[model samples]
Target chain A: MRKGFRTDLRWSDVTPKEKWLNRRQLMAGAGALVLAAPALAQGTAAPGRYSTDEPPTSLEDISGYNNFYEFGYDKEDPARLAQGLTVDPWSVVIDGLVDRPGTYALDDLLSGVTLEERIYRFRCVEAWSMVVPWVGFELAALLGRVGVQPGARYVAFETLLRPEEMPGQRGGTIEWPYREGLRLDEAMHPLTLLATGIYNEPLPKQNGAPIRLVVPWKYGFKSIKSIVRISLVADRPQTTWNMLQPNEYGFYSNVNPQVDHPRWSQASERRVGGGLLAPRIDTLMFNGYADEVASLYAGMDLTRDF
Target chain B: MDGAASLNGALRRVPVWAVCGLGLVPLAVLVWRGLSGGLGIDPVKTLEHQLGLTALQLLLAGLVVTPLRRWTGVNLIRYRRAIGLLAFLYAALHLLVWLWLDLQLRWSEIGADLVKRPYVIVGMLGFACLVPLAMTSNGWSVRRLGAAAWQRLHRLAYAAVLLAALHYLLLVKVWSAEPLLYALAAAGLVALRWLWRRGRSGTVRA
Candidate 1:
């Protein structure tokens, strides 16, 4: 590793995001304000270790805008069309090279680990980005709970496929049931999260509902939303974007500003909630999470892997 | 046929400049949207798409002038030049928004995109086709170049409109009906003359 992915900054040294708020009434206004609460409840937890002190993106922008192709192609389509999606009584199937392989209810699967708030920098492959305050436990905790098999080298994730509610699926926008994967080491990385909430509120239907993965270092698509199936496999699994266009997207979609997408420049990004005032800010190495996740791809050339 | 002729005669009194001025309505809506919360989540993107769509829609409307005169006998031919120029204005504004607001004039990256990305190339070529047409959209230029040569030069609008539609269609990461519909409409407009002639050649006199 050129420079170690280690920050000397302690969790306590960094201020809690709540302290950054100018007004106390803002606490009540936190998270997405769209309609009522979601059907499922993962319950709230205390702030986590890796929470960024940066002022988070507004809940309105975070929940209102989305890239959920299952809902539709437009950013607004998810909010407009995904309201009817049924996320209650959800379950996730843990299969492949796990010691215990079975369908577990959403609550049971996420039962043991303590959920905590982690405000992270989220960068989309389209070169737009947001800093979301996500609430969840690390994927490592879940993998530990499920018990990874000896030969498992990769972790594949699949999103919930419900066509009747998701009209974009009816249009054959994708192959249906979007899939994503990560190397075993990447999956087990402490920074890798399976989020249940945003801004300490239950995730909205448009913003990946019951459960979603958040890999802060990678492009937003790599953090597959509304995940249902998680497989610990011996081989690297196919991903939706990678399978669609391998030239553009890659399995190791770690945010490297050096590598540019065909459509979007990875060198910089338009901040989603920054409005008209803010100019496009320069993108950082590993989206500024380089200190945390850089070691994972130590010797590999990201330009080639990307 | 008499009703169509009367409607066409009445349309002539509305003034071509008034119709061209009415094209600013969409831009006004855009301004209102930017002021209010209606520009959606990413306002830059919403603004860019709106301007681009308005340009395409106006270009298609200009294309329909001939078909309307031929088939329906509603001659909008008087307002065609104004409509075409207004469409060019919107297209230029769309390019400006993309450069200034969206890309922020990152010339090096923009140059790379023009070279590497097919959609960007398509959009650039479409805009390039409009530049000459827009520059020469004057009576003096028409007189200098002569009507025949000017008309030949103006055919670039067809290529520009088709490319604009294709740019939109290609830009989408997933299959979307909206862009596809626009593409289909553009294709129909581009082939309108040939399609109309083939259907009428069997019976109808010019």
Candidate 2:
């Protein structure tokens, strides 16, 4: 949660000082004692291994299932359908207001950055969640390379559009080839990530393949997958969802429990397969990344702007 | 007396009820799994997969009945009703799982999904078409409708099968070879039926 703390060891290093007690193990051991004690004497339920200091239910579960329309629309469609995507020759074209505007190979983009294992809650706009351990450098670090001009107000992302490689493009389901955008400040948030992998493994093709953006605070779609282009522009870029249904999916698709999606309430999300025992947790404003990204939208009325 | 003896012989050779009972194994297994909580941690996904696969299997089985009957010269016509019914049963289960488990019985949301999602719409269409076919499968309805009308009504199953395949294909974002394979098989079956019908009509005209 610190702003600029750099630990010398690589994320994979199993250093004794770096390794902490597993929270799940601790909870399993102490849960019975806490349950037996008098109700008044008992403290709040001990946070589990993946628990963070962020406000309860505010932090989006980061590892939730994703429906990257590129792969397929089904929740598991990405995993099975994405396998056919060719990711080896992936390149991202950076254009618009930036000084350095050229296509960069995915390997070049990942070369110098240090990967950090950040565990964050990821809440989908569809109302589901999961805690994911993402392996990537901060989005701020990546954006720093492509110096933003003073007038630059927004960042636009474009996903791959080849029909041959992506059969979903052949259909007219969602206007084909997906696109997403974010405000420059939101794009540069420290918590935002240009993630290349998950669970320490190279991202499966269905999960955006070579590289995908992970904006924990925003709706999952805003974190575009199979990104092939990024444009720095003065005006807000037209996003896919906003284009499809502006009334439903606003340009600023931030996770706000108050602003219900036109069809369904965004107030709560099921933790996919969390079963009958685990209650659907209430969704948090800003997906529980408020302390980190709330100030960016502080004065703006999120309900109207949302 | 000869016609009566032939009719009696055909009825005696094939025990339609026993064959229909045998087809109930899959449904029994599905129910057992649901009750025992063997649907796994993600019951929705499990149910969806099972129902989808069962629908595919039943469709395949129904397609095979005609070919097998023609090749073996056996009274496979009797089993057609049972196969058609089983396909309807699995399709209904597929619809129910989506309704109860996926949509949580929220009719408004279900309506919205049907309207917005093309796959859901196609699936509903397929299921709706199967309803009339299943309803008229009985001997009484067949007798009332007559053979010509009955065959015309039952031809809707071909459309239902195609719609079901399309529904499966569109539902997934990525095209898995499995769904594509099923689609291809369904296409072949429908094509074969058309060809056979055309051949029979040509011979009759000649």
Q: Quantify all predictions' global Cα lDDT against the true fold.
A: 0.83, 0.71
lDDT, candidate 2, A3-33, per-residue tens = 1113343444422211222432343467745
Interface RMSD for every prediction, one decimal? 1.8, 6.3
Per-prediction TM-score, please?
Answer: 0.88, 0.60
Instruction: Tell me how far the alpha carbon of residue A197 in candidate 1 is from the true structure, in angstroms, after superposition.
Output: 0.9
All DockQ scores:
0.60, 0.13
DockQ of predicted model 2: 0.13
Please provide, for model 2 over B168-203, each residue's C-alpha lDDT reduced to its tens digit, 9 standing for 90 to 100: 887553346778898998898889888887778453
Q: Is the docking of candidate 1 incorrect, acceptable, medium or high quality?
A: medium
Tens digits of per-residue lDDT, candidate 1, A1-306, equal 001113343434433435433322344466533211321121234567787777788888999989998988778899999999998878899999998899988878666567777889999998899989898889999899889999999999999988888888886647879999999999999999989888656788899988899999899999988889999999889999998889889999888888988675688889998676456888999989888888888999888999
Candidate 1 shows a clash count of: 0
Docking class of 2: incorrect
